[model samples]
Target: MNFDEQTVLVTGAGRGLGTSIARAFAHQGARVVVNYRASAVSAEQLAAEIGGLAVQADITVAEEMDALFTAAEQHFGTTVTTVVNNALADFSFNGDARSKADSISWEQFDAQFQGTVRGALTTTQRALPGMRTAGFGRIINVGTNLFQNPVVPYHDYTASKAALLSLTRTLAADLGVDGITVNMVSGGLLRTTDASAATPEAVFDLIAASTPLQRVVTPAEFADALLFFASPWSRSVTGQNLVVDGGLVKD
Candidate 1:
């Protein structure tokens, strides 16, 4: 779990919170692999800045996921030891524009499911052989606190993340013998990520007031939890969901 010796792959790391998570891993001396489905310019820029590799792959596609790991391993001369499932489907956290319960379509839920659950599944499966061979791996899934708080009831997003949490646990049980750990880091609405940029100022103020920290969590702050799950500090922890919402959701 020494990040200095780890090659970390972060899905959807071209922008937003994923970018912060990628930077955090690189800062800790991990050989970071910035995986992007789009936003190539930003991804490449980030990779250059951090001295990491930027690989483009749609996490939901098995072929792409396979290529992603292959490219990373070939570039770094090592397999990825840490995998961060941080990519989200195209979504805007605009409560006003969201589909209501009565009007919500199954397609909406399915889209999120493909992005959150399926994406993680593909990436994990692709990364397994390397992890098994090395006998050390970290699968850190990105999740949401809405499952516990449901403040805005983002039905599709919350539900998909809920499914991801389930996957996180089951994978932990199945992979522990191989020396791999799976965990989740869930966060409330972040201050100003691209997805959260659509959130009204008033809503952000309200959420900040509700938290014990009296401020919305930043992407960088939420990213710190990802490090713990991937580091030696969390060696004994697996299949656990750590909520980092500035105390917005006590659970």
Candidate 2:
């Protein structure tokens, strides 16, 4: 919980889960970099409130990520040692509108992968030099529980997150020698994130009723699991997927 010397960068931190994660890191005394692809206003406002830097960078684009880091280091007076890959593709959580496996296009799947897997890879790669030089780093990827349960069968979204989990483990193995720990935090349908806003109230109620906790997880609740990864307490933990869906997946 003490992140005094860490410089944290959170992607898509303009709103929702990303916003919550960034806030948590800032509150814990980490010099936070709020990276936003859009939502400039919200991102800037949050940065001002938390005393962090707001930078615009599309994680999918390498050049933009470079600029983001350069700007962050210049502004924060240090390189980023902690990264939270929480950016998500622009997709509404309307189960009724989601495409079936047979009807889903490869392009749709690719887009999700670009946001979840590729974006994480790009950010991780960019942060490596800084982390390597500092001899410490924390890479926490935000993921979904759909891959384990697949209750809604969001083929494209679920497939992309599965790929992300694979990357998380490999990166953990590769970076362990460099004092960097890579891990994932997976959550089920959150109570009310921008992505989940389109989900029906009845659907949310049904999901809550099915879970042992009788409630959907909150962004803040899932974000705390992410903090465990970045904190010194999890010094020996890596390459693991921690599900934060109120025991819905049991992983």
Candidate 3:
């Protein structure tokens, strides 16, 4: 997709899937804003490599998120027309380390909600006015298939993503009048992202065998689905979740 006329803000884009998403947008000609919370070095490197602006902001903090948007506009001389909410709480995808419901605490769930749900809320609010004024916008929330098939019982992570999906639909309904579309791209067990680096090779083999395509999805492959949501072809599509997991879970 050609994003020559658009500016994109990708959260948690210092590495992992965020890195792939940022690079994809830049490759497509978008003035990209790479937002990172703590991965400053990596984020800056990726931004420099892609010719994007590397901005640091903790998505859970409204003030910081606002600053990120401000920085994006100043650097690109244009409002961010697209946002990819890809920032994830620091996590190690080790199924063995995950807390089962019996051992999980509310604090764990709260942390996930703050990062996954509230963060999206804050960024959407900041970007709304600009989108409304321009009558064009695209909000793509990253999600996962764990909610559909909690194979590993990652209750906290799955719950947060489920909440994000709720916001995606509701926001789409409320923002469509302004030509802003809200959608989600859900994937399952990305091959080797920072968060998923701990996943055992056996788990990957298991998931790959279960999917019709017989392979775990890649971050770049998942990013294309997000781009479609922002592209003109999906102008009329909103409040929908597109699963891009090599057909692991059909919805």
Q: In each prediction, how many residue pairs overlap at the backbone (N, C-alpha, C within less than 3 A)? A: 0, 0, 0
lDDT of 1 at 146: 94
Best by lDDT: 1
TM-score of model number 1: 0.99
Alpha-carbon error at 120 in model 3, in Å?
Answer: 0.6
Q: Write the per-residue lDDT of candidate 1 for residues 1-251, one digit (tens) a residue.
A: 69999999999999999999999999999999999987999999999999999999999889988888888889999988999999999999999999999999999999999999999999999999999999999999999999999989899999999999999999999999999999999999998899999999999999999999999999999998889998999999999999999998987
Off by over 4 Å in 3: none
Q: Report the error of model 1 at residue 59, Å.
A: 0.6
Model 3: clashing residue pairs? none
Which lDDT tens digits does candidate 3 get at residues 1-251?
24888899999999899999998888888889999988999999999899999998999888997888888888888888999999998777899889987889999999999989988898889999888878899999999998998879898999999999999999999999888999999999998899999999999999999999999999998887788887878988999999999998877
Best by TM-score: 1
Candidate 3's error at 132, in angstroms? 0.9
- Tens digit per residue, CA lDDT, model 2, 1-251: 25989999999999999999998988898999999988999999999999999999989999999999999999988989999999998888899999987799999999999999899999999999999999999999988899999889999999999999999999999999999999999999998899999999999999899889999999999888898999989999999999999888875
